[model samples]
Target chain A: MAGEASSGTFLQGLERGLAVIRAFSAQAPSLTLSEVARDVGLTPATARRILLTLEQLGYVRTDGRQFSLTPRVLALGWAYLSSLDLGELAGPYMEELSAATRESCSIATLDLPDIVYVARVPTSRIMTVALGVGARLPAYPTSMGRVLLAGLSSSELDVYLANMQTEQLTPRTVTSASLLRAAVDQARADGYALVDQELELGLRSLAAPIYNSRGRVVAALNVSAHASRSTPESLCEEVLPHVLCAADHITTALKHRGHL
Target chain B: MAGEASSGTFLQGLERGLAVIRAFSAQAPSLTLSEVARDVGLTPATARRILLTLEQLGYVRTDGRQFSLTPRVLALGWAYLSSLDLGELAGPYMEELSAATRESCSIATLDLPDIVYVARVPTSRIMTVALGVGARLPAYPTSMGRVLLAGLSSSELDVYLANMQTEQLTPRTVTSASLLRAAVDQARADGYALVDQELELGLRSLAAPIYNSRGRVVAALNVSAHASRSTPESLCEEVLPHVLCAADHITTALKHRGHL
Candidate 1:
């Protein structure tokens, strides 16, 4: 169920093997052969074959009887790091923004209805939130992703709205497509987005988009904090300016590097 | 050439696919078909085939015919995040340490001769070092890894030392085995490690191991800053105590969770 079914013989073995590797993460960095089998929904025999395969390839290592991930797994993340023009160019500006506000800040891109964090600087980690690099949150609910989506073409927005499977993450989560669209429109007009206890309870965030030289938003940058620390009004009044400034700085950096 | 020769019979195709995926990063999130091929030293046709396969697998997406990574890539790192009991358990403590020192902090596990960062709370990216959640650094040179290595058994340390290929990242890098072994021994005796201008010229870091209830060091924690900001004296005097305190707090948390 995790992968698309390809017509004819299109690397089923490779797909299964890759799924096994992907099965290991910060959450499940080590597993017994059977745990991996259940996680990837493959048979135990198949999982063992894949794990053995991965071990032989040096992407994984076994300790006596227990299995653990190897540092070689990092090569996958490094590939994306080595090739992304936006993430690299945004570094100095992200640091500047983090320094300017002394708050946790991040850059994320919209992966359709979800926002995947591509970069982050954690000034603090709220006990309830797991907001780290490579973390994901629903796009319709997160400030950064919504801001990025605000720049989408109307048709693209419509597609997202149509396909969105809304689940109320918290009391503030807007499950109605119309409400979400209105929020996106407001974000476009104001050039920023604010989410107040929508994605997670007691978390508030403000975001602004980083535009390429082509004027298309390639990413979004934001500052996030506890709702107790960031009232909606104060965020809009105090933090919004800094978020917008950071976005502009990132935009300028991107343009200077011709990444637009 | 980067992999063991016998690996081809195992998950080599998946490894190559991961290599293709790893080729993209915050620095290079997107790559032309030919550029990816060139960077990975794969034939253009082979790279194209792999990219097509990755696209089908939802790992990569095309933004107007140019290949860009999707949030799905985070799934790989997420596996590590979700699997590692140590990282999740260490989160709150890391944040506290980051706040206390007002500097970046991270936890790493020794991956033989290298250390792979498992959990981190980066305060800022002032020096343009864009290390991410799954980043790798030389174990002998990084404070966290050295601290972790200091806790290793003699045989384990011998194997690690025997296999180390110390590339001089900076002029200050420790290349001699005896010097590196002495540093490890000192760390074992003092219960902390200090690294200055070794990995990055301006960076200074201090680390301490986090022991579980079993009194075994499972991970290493460190606080890093610019040399101008945290001199060797300041790091040992000011930073080491705080790092050790945070490490103890994290160990208690891990014990409470019954993960120790």
Candidate 2:
């Protein structure tokens, strides 16, 4: 509000439009006119106006009486993807790790207090991790998030740890600041992290930081498996090595491409 | 513009703010105050206004006098990627094909006039086709795009082809609508498409339609190789079989997951 008030020319409509678009999701991909109004906390008339504008821009589409997102909404993602070289540089390496380990692999970039899975490769096995590209997991308890956090400066990590809201996701989720700091410190020392059954009941993951040419961690690469399939020792001994190799390869490629 | 005007209550401020955000890119990851105005074709005052508003909303950050995008932009892409099941279901198959051929493999859903690469697996050795996960390519010439187009009903294809603008990217680019239609027809008849030197010289690709449980082609999967490495015949003989099998695996997985 300070920035907007100081600049003195805020675009309230754009903010509302973005808010309305964000209101629809996996559980509420399709919304009736009244539902959109209720979800966005706007009057029905105002919500209808925003929806109509979004529909015109090809960001929203309607089926009969309910509104749903159109594929054109992908343009927003395209804009970010096209502008970022990290994904391109890390792609092959992620593929290699997925093949070598025979498990689902992913790359995530930290987005505030959560980690957003930006890229994922499933291994054609029947496994449930409840994580997908763009799916967010609390940073305190996820392997990829912790690996990414390890790269942050000490002061930045302190701030993050201070703001972290400890919640019980599962019995394994870390809730204490001192414990979280120790986990992050271990990740910093070892160059990898393992999260077992913290976010999901049977999910386990091993992750290593994917560094840019500057040796800064811009993303984290991970291998996720069901608890039955991947033991803690096996994942660290076997899967982590492969993932680190792949991350090293990706970092070299990024350096060659001048992404440093 | 027509769509917005018809709606009778358009948000011009939101449009201008989004345009300002879109002006930044990988090369221009951070921009000075004047640079933002130049790219978006707005006055510096107007650009400053939008930028300030965005900063207030946590979408943009200012470092001294320069402006850059924040991780919050990922929120927009996260919205789309999380809502769609295609990218998650198609990941492993794409990785397998990439590993087998040592080339980039992609899964794309058609957005008219363009195809957005929803998921991709890049091969380490080749950097020629390093399209990122959410990059977009012209639909008229890409192997994956044509395969998806071939799945559309005849009337739908007719309408799409009529409005398309084909820019010649290479000597082999299909500039004739009828010829392009014929190619689509051939893909429909054969259930696969091979496009060589159309979008990029020395690039050859093979693609197949990926059907959901209801048997609709919701996406297309493709293997792209250097022309010198793969002849059209070799692609058909070596890659087509695996492409088809990977597609079948994804389709079956989608059904089991109830994504269809």
Q: How many backbone clashes does candidate 1 have?
A: 32
Report the poorest 10 consecutive residues by lDDT, candidate 2 chain B.
B1-10
Local error of candidate 1 at A189, Å?
4.7
lDDT of each: 0.76, 0.77
Residue-level lDDT of model 2, residues A1-260, one tens digit each, is: 21222214666666777787788676776788899999888888778888887787777777657886666666665455445555555767776788899887888888779887666666763222245445677788889989999999999999998998978899998989999999999999999999999978899998988777678898888898899997999898888889889878877787787633
Q: Compared to the true structure, candidate 1 yields what TM-score?
A: 0.81
Stretch of 10 with least lDDT, candidate 1 chain A:
A1-10
- lDDT string, candidate 2, B184-227, tens digits: 99998998889999999999999888887778887898998899
Worst 10 residues of 2 chain A by lDDT: A1-10
**What tens-digit string does per-residue lDDT give for candidate 1 at B148-195?**
889899998888888788878889999788899999999999989998
Give each model's clash number: 32, 1
